[model samples]
Target: MLKVNTENSVRYKGKPKKTSVNAGRLKLIERNKEKPDVARIEKPTTILRGMRLIDPNEVNKNMICSNCRKQLAFNHIVEEKTTGFHHIWTMKCDTCFTLTKCHSSKSHFNDGHLYYDANTAAVLGAVHSGAGCNALRKIAMRIDMPVLSQETYKRYEREIGSLIEEAAKDSCQGAAAEEQNLVVEHIDTLRDKL
Candidate 1:
């Protein structure tokens, strides 16, 4: 049923004997092999064609460390191609390394690609300032900047419109409070005069 060699190696029925290599030596060899790959960070093995470059420092500034509440340090950009191609910027906290900022260059809702530049922000601002989609489309014709489609613009508005409305309502509430205080002061003065 089983065969035993002179070296005490066992072989099962019709099965070849298993060869053993020292686990420690195998791990050492693997570590040696990985060193060169780790050293060559300039030439990343995973390369993405037509990947857009974004300012790492700008992204770092926007990211906050979840652990220490400090700014996150930009580590690198990685391109992912699952449903669609997208660039993800990886960041981590320098002090504790507890916080991670994994930002994607594509909208999660499939509205469009990420836009960080002032020109794109300005176009979005115009939309936020009550400009209609048709008007923005006409403006896009006059300008060289790529304007988002009316459908995409509507999606963007739907995604962030609640936040904008909340901020506006907060501002209005503060203004109303101030106005109420001023009116109460005037009423008090009038009562004193009476």
Candidate 2:
């Protein structure tokens, strides 16, 4: 900044004359301060958990929910606890409580969604709820026909199939809801144009 004296001279030096500045102006000047920390993003809340599986190395790349058939992640397959000789790896989906498996067998079936009838599933020693379904499927799936009963067959015939479908649709709902909100807001803003 340049200073002028009463004699109309630009050189108004007085032992480095210091001018006072307003507090607000001082604040406006940028300061050399430490940078802020970056925020960490969180994982989705709906991710499923508690699934049981067998072989991680042999997990199917395309294996997904058997009911909804939504493609599942390899890491999401939870291991089921069982009394067996072969080593197994398992996981449970966080979004839905669907239990999946990857059993170590001779047939070479990789990581696949182990689905079971909700009704006969119980007879096979697997209950529908996380109460212990994955653990049951690991043992029962190997037994052909799994001793299906008349009542069990009639009851869970449709439920197990629907579980997968519902899960798939649910996985897409959160994004759809956000999109729908944007659309609604846009329509409201453009109401005068219509």
Candidate 3:
């Protein structure tokens, strides 16, 4: 067995241990330690520019900032068409740089490819409300909005169905376990009475 007390010391079987620091190396390290440049220090405000403003409506045309309640100006128009069309009017609040999006209608935007974006919350709402794919399609058609394929609606249904099934199973298991504990206690009390 071998024991070494120095941090730089190393030992091997049947070999002598060596530990030393070169004087020239220490001088070289000291010479290379330079102070950071004062000019390179970043201003904190530069980072704040990348943050999103509190009011999203500030991006729309002639809209008031939802936060500051100040009138905003139209920045520009973002028009694009894929399945349908989109004419998005952008506005910004000069005070806080809050952006807001303005569309022609809440149901549909300027004949865009799709009627609504159908975010997670909206899709889950439709599933919970029992709105079938055909019903959704009919509603879109009635509103003159571009309708998505039945497959998309089916996919949403499947996703929501699985989540519901999982929650139901978990609840059933929890109830069963609680009931079993209660039944065991009741049986024990009846046996004592006998």
Candidate 4:
């Protein structure tokens, strides 16, 4: 039986030696170590940016007449126009008889044409998420939410599809140009070495 000495054996008490890190990797590590500024983070004014499934009773409870400062009754909603997921409600104040137009989503103007933000977003989101109009309609139906017609969905899909295709072409061209530049630089370096 062989006995080993434990007391005389030198144990490392100093800090562990760090392995060499690449300059780019070191920068990433330093960046990740930095704490984000909590004060700089802004909270969204509304619950969600796009369409939200809100109860009609909740809207009635929170609604106030702009002119009279009285609670607007749910029954006072004179007209409602739904475009895809977006909704515009025209309400008449009982006290002041003032008509107020409420919009569920903001409007964006492009080439002098007004487009609902939510409606555009819905089509874009559907395409990005690999979901079609049928899928969206089924989900809406299941949730008891108002569903957009196939015609309306198809119209937005066509418009957005063209835009997406254009963007993809631009991106591919940019990437090709960058790759060509890199190849040219590499050839120049080889010529210099020769």
lDDT of 3 by residue, 1-194 (tens): 77666676545455545544344555667776665445565432221111121224423433666557776543322222222222334545667766655543333333554334333334556677888666766766776665656666566567667878999899999999999999787997878889
Off by over 4 Å in 1: 1-123, 192-194
Which scores greater on TM-score, model 3 or model 4? 4
lDDT by residue for model 2 (77-181), tens: 445333322223354556675766544322222256444322334533333454344444454555522333444443453555576577778879987999889
What lDDT would candidate 4 get against the real structure?
A: 0.70
State model 2's lDDT: 0.46
- The global Cα lDDT (0 to 1) of model 3 is 0.52
Off by over 4 Å in 3: 1-75, 81-117, 143-145, 188-194
- TM for candidate 3 is 0.37
TM-score of 1: 0.38
| True-vs-predicted CA distance for residue 90, candidate 4, Å | 1.5
Order of candidate numbers by TM-score, starting with the best: 4, 1, 3, 2
Residue 156's lDDT in candidate 1: 62
Q: Estimate each model's TM-score.
A: 0.38, 0.21, 0.37, 0.57
The C-alpha stretches of model 4 lying farther than 4 A from their native spots are: 1-76, 108-116, 188-194
